[model samples]
Target: MNLVTQLPVSGAAPKLLDFPAPTVSGLPTPALRGKPVPPAQRVYFYSPDEWEVFITEWASGLSYRQIKQLGGSGDRGVDVAAFKTDNGLEGAWDCFQAKHYNRSLNFSDAFPEMLKILHGVVAGFYCRPDRYVFVAPQGCGSTLDRLLSRPKELQKKFLEDLNKSSAATRHYPKQTLNSIREYAQSIDFSIFQSLQLSEMIETHRKTPYFAARFGTALPERTVVKETPVTPSPDEAVYVKKLLDVYNEQDPACCSDVDSLSVHTTYGKQFQRQRESFYSAEALRLYARDSVPDGTYELLQKDVYTGVIDTAEANHPSGLDRLRAVLTQSGQLDLSAHTLISVSTLEDRQGICHQLANADKLTWVDTNE
Candidate 1:
């Protein structure tokens, strides 16, 4: 029941579509928000590559450093793959297929992906993903969207379309066709779904790093959805080591892991990690929103830039300097800018030195 089999006939893979180069400006507004001119309308402006990156990061709740793009020749139809761990088993994968078609996406756009996924499943190219998403800027056409909503209708339609006598399947060798027919009967149609660029933009608007990505104002805490992440085995071990080190440094400082977690530096890092976990958890609530790819890195760069500008200008401290710059530019709410974690003045100052050493003090102004 979990398997999906509405597949295309096998053939040499089609060339990748020619997507327009991505840019931050000049994004088209989507029809859905035409008159009202909704916030985040620029989402419709993203290149397919940009959309794919955003989808991977936002949906997976992975930090910018963790996501990997796999779109290209030999990608096997999957544009992005996000690695996740849950329940200690690890490897909970989600696959995103990006279709950057200029026109509204129709069955033809989806069929080859279906074929690739079905054939991949049979051949074990990858494990059955927890979610298999079809991402596009224009979104799905009426028929496909309707079918996606009603699984049985989708199953019936797919089978009928790929019937033995249908031209779509006529070219498949008999053995392949027979195999596909058998597979189609048992494939699960529910895994197939679509997301529109506009919806994704709306979702991204509420993320913590949204302002950094689009140069829009940050959402208030009330609207800032949190994303939570599962502690991988490695991360868990690292946390344990941090706590253990704290205990060794000052036995009087902590009696157990819980107590050690309260130490200044370690505690702050732990809290940040906990925030990340919650942010990941929040991602599920905004399944359609994806932080545009590289948003986090951009935020990091901006924060660093703010820090340096403040230091050079003789601002009170790195923390105060960064906050003043971001707040003045209207990109941050000084009362609650949780985009980066710095528990103390020392931590803030240390970050400035680190960024300075790396020679990466260039910050983008909200105006820019």
Candidate 2:
């Protein structure tokens, strides 16, 4: 009997099978399914040290001449220091104090750090930073936020707390604490501020390290430059090699780029090759701004490795060798490369030409 026919029929309607709904226990949540974590909440997930590192990277992208992470023991309350001049803290500088707490920072959480900075300056540890920015994932609590906006009130509260508690002065003598208080009173408290998580993430987005840090997509590749009407000095090496290949095929076919430009057979071929070369050049420039150092070079190395054996093999002429090696390059399995998604067939062919320009791959075997 067919399965459908074997089912028992109800008096008024066909009976339905009572199969339990399939249980999906291990399915990914929205975040795993490509939903991005908001930067505000995501910063809280970083460890204290990692948060310091993130701030350092973000500061490096700014106009600061130097950035240093001083987060461990004996750091004297500075987490990340951004120097505006080569002289470092001896000159103008800004301080970023990273606090990676589960909750927002309050006046109590910030007061001690402020005292530490004041003490550092008075103790000759370093000059007072031009700006003291508190960097926390949850930002400042309402109470602390209000105090920051009113610099005088914040200073008054800081002094009151300094006298009431020894949190920042336990190891120091009364004279030292007095010195810190006097130093604090002398400087402008307006320098105290807080960096919002959104502001930090926005600035960090301009840096090459953002994608790696946040698991975000890289910026789109820019358009490739149009091939020039005439060969440029930069194209001299590859252009010379292409002329040699054409000459090998037929000595009278072309002697130089000027003659080759008007050749009936090779002129169009030369233009297409230049387009491919520029395509790869565009990729190189994109990789510079989008990926880590040496990423584009690695792609070029991969192309050279895939085609070198074919290039070395015997061929009827230099033109034949060039065609064979380019074919081999096109067939390379570059899916593993970081740039594979943005790469193109033209780029692969152009990279072979780039290798030729570098003297790494010569179509015409001079010794032979």
lDDT of each: 0.52, 0.78
Given candidate 2, what's the lDDT at residue 239?
85
The prediction achieving the highest lDDT against the true structure is 2
- For 67-90, candidate 2 gives per-residue lDDT tens digits of 776633677768778889988777
Model 1 root mean square deviation, Cα atoms:
12.3
Model 2 misplacement above 4 A: 1-31
Q: Score every model by TM-score.
A: 0.50, 0.84
Per-residue lDDT over 1-368 for candidate 1, one digit per residue giving the tens place of the 0 to 100 score: 33333443244432333232223321222224335434445556777666675675455344322344663587766776655654211246666788876777787677767766656554445555666788877788998888888877887877776664654565456666566556767768888888766666666555533544555433432343442334445345334433443444466865555665667655565455345433433332322243333433344454564544444575433334444543443332222332333223332333332343344432322122
Error of 2 at 111 (Å): 1.7
Error of 2 at 292 (Å): 2.4
